[model samples]
Target: MGRMTDQPARWTQATVYPDMWVDPDDDPRNSEGRAPDGELATLADFLANYRMTLRMKCEGLDAEQLARRSAPPSTMSLLGLVRHLAEAERDWRRWISDGDPLPKLYGARDADFDGAVAEPGEIEAAYEALAREQAATDAALAAHPDLGERLGRDGIAVRELLVHRIEEYARHCGHADLLRERIDGRVGQ
Candidate 1:
């Protein structure tokens, strides 16, 4: 059977909330308050939410499912997104480092995605790298509370970096949503 046969008879079978990954009541991404009190808090919240969404989208899938490409002519996969985001987070940490920037996690362009093969150790390592990089980046960001102050050799503003981080996560999260839905017909916010 082809890829089409791998899917459910109806896409709706695996969906809830009109194909949502999780019900709103139980979704960890949902928050009760307004967009926080300031620019930094709001941006942080958005980034955090996007990160959680990415994890949720990858939940309950095996190695093969996570690494499966969405379609021909495209190399994108949920596992690739996870690895790519790890690289992105590591870059942010390096960008904000007080001293010399850290070396690239994957050490090659597109390696984050391209190297996301469906292997036992590969999946675990990807998740580990993502978590590690995210924590490091968060710490680096927290150390420089002043969003307007510049960091790194390039002197880019902290606010700009945060916004860029959010943008990257947001874009990949969208890609993840589609990839998950295609894999099993499960979809949602």
Candidate 2:
């Protein structure tokens, strides 16, 4: 949640920490990966890990830092990622599960990232949006348990979407890692 401005040097009590962002013993997100007996369980596990990784990277930052664009020329901020994921979650619900062609969460054409400006109360709002969108999407996915069965007009399998969701989160988590590192010297997870 805090930043190390120098990026090159920061306090790490030891070089070998157990997890990204914190030691495994202290990380709330840390857990033993389960031996999933089904495709849905496996996909859900990875998706949840990456999803929580993003949130963990955002811990303790104020709006200014959250909205701070770590890599210049790229509109990807930690907050922006949060906002984008919120849109993504909604997209999954409307276009994939529900098959409703609704407008973008923020607006058209990357508005989720574009509109991710630093403002008072916006950080909390974005987090809330992400949570809400994820919950709705989760409920929809839970409603249809057959992973091999295709859903919606896209002809994408439920299993495919679940895997895609994990991929999406993992990609964003990578961005968050570099961004958080640059914003402050802290890096991990």
User: Residue 181 deviation, candidate 1, in Å?
Assistant: 1.2
Residue 40 error for model 2, in Å?
1.4
Q: Assess each prediction's global lDDT (C-alpha) against the native.
A: 0.84, 0.79
Which residue pairs collide in model 2, if any? Answer: 1-59, 3-184, 4-184, 4-185, 20-188, 20-189
Clash numbers, per candidate: 2, 6
For residues 9-94, what per-residue lDDT tens digits would candidate 1 score against the true structure? 32432334655555666777746556688889899999999999899888889999999987877878999999999888987876
Off by over 4 Å in 2: 1-8, 11-20
Count backbone overlaps in model 1: 2
